[model samples]
Target: MTEPRTFTLRDDLKLALELADAADAISRARFTALDLVVTTKPDRTPVTDADQAVERAIRTVLAEQRPGDGILGEEFGTAGSTSRQWIIDPIDGTAGFMRGIPIWATLIALAVDGVPVVGVVSAPALGKRWWASAGAGAWSSDERTPNASPTRLAVSGVDTLAEASISYGSLQQWDQAGHLDEIVSLSRQVWRTRAYGDMWSYMLLAEGHLDMAGEFDLQPYDMAALAPIVQEAGGVFTSIDGKPGPWHGSALATNGLLHDATLAVLNPA
Candidate 1:
């Protein structure tokens, strides 16, 4: 197998777009097949299928195009090296999806020596895909607008917590993590709040439509794809405790201006 090309960010960005196409195919199909009739709580089969299928598709492509590269997937586990690993989460908001909500998507990212350098979020049901490569601008496409160029994205300038809008992934996640009060406190201090519960929240922030995004109990795949997009869009991406990377098990993403203030509020004594 040939070594993976250490392409420029432009090439990486193009690959991210191709990966989004593959992910959308598997994800949208399963999403459409889901019954979405929350009888009791929610089901996981639809997400499991979508997740595995999407990861398999990505793996197949990487094997052919970047043979020496590694992969870490939510459904398939790890394979190959970590030097140029591809991380994937084929379906990020299974619960919302199972309940007939449109907040789910597939997250694809390339982490070089554990630092995510390229990221893509494809939510077909929502008709949007967002992506970014290190040093490249963040971008998004709307399937609703056929053939239109993807718009460059940027974070908002709401500098104060009182003026910022925020979305934490899930109330249940915070409650389970014993940080519900901290989350609630932060929400009250912020101008707006919503548990958009997945990729949608972060994408909204990257588009300058929201000011803050944070969550707990996340894996690397959940946060990796988000980091580059948020960073490229002029936002800060870090752990809730103010750590600078996605390995910290929690996340706090905000337009660069409001990051520190949001960190102060999210940190529990």
Candidate 2:
């Protein structure tokens, strides 16, 4: 089979789902294995055997299915053409994953030029998967309804911060990013808050369970898959300073209605 120089949004999305399946097979088996190898990357973040294997598996699949596309993976770094790149986080919440927590997932995204056009977040431990393409809308399925048609996702209608339920990855993230006082003030204004951390927070927002979710110190692999799901679900994804796309160092996602307000609270100037 010949590889096309470009793929349609639907085709890219289909391939992403296939890559997720390849990833889940490896990750699920190593989730809590007694001998799961653990090591640190140059930046001091944890990398487990599952993370390495999942990324390698997905890369292998992409090589077979989309040979011409580029790849930006957490474990393997970058390769190939930038025009049609695949961004992947083999396991988004590695720390929690290594500890037997079920918050980790394989995040796959297809970016055309620099914009994400397809995304798939698959969490096998939680038995849930969410996906979206540029115009196909966001959808999800859980263990209970895995074979059933996915439930379409839509952002909640909570327009006011006073009534909004918010999730910031962690208080320490804000503090470490030199915005501790800002988060403290924002937390006081929200109706409720929790630290849902990683891809789950944005997924919850996309599914209409939360109004806003933001975090600091993120890489492109961490936010690329998430931005499209939130956008297709009728939400907004931007940098903490309101820039577009996932290249920025931080992420601020909200139900469309509350985006401007949330941005104001985070950036007072």
Clashing residue pairs in all predictions, respectively, total 0, 0
Q: Which candidate wins on lDDT?
A: 2
Deviation from native of the Cα of residue 238 in model 2, angstroms: 0.3
Model 2 lDDT-worst window of ten: 2-11
Worst 10 residues of 1 by lDDT: 36-45
Model 2 regions more than 4 Å off: 1-5
Show pairs that collide, candidate 2.
Answer: none
Report the CA-based lDDT of candidate 1 relative to the real structure.
Answer: 0.84
Candidate 2 is scored at a TM of 0.97
List ranges where model 1 is wrong by over 4 Å: 1-5, 34-47
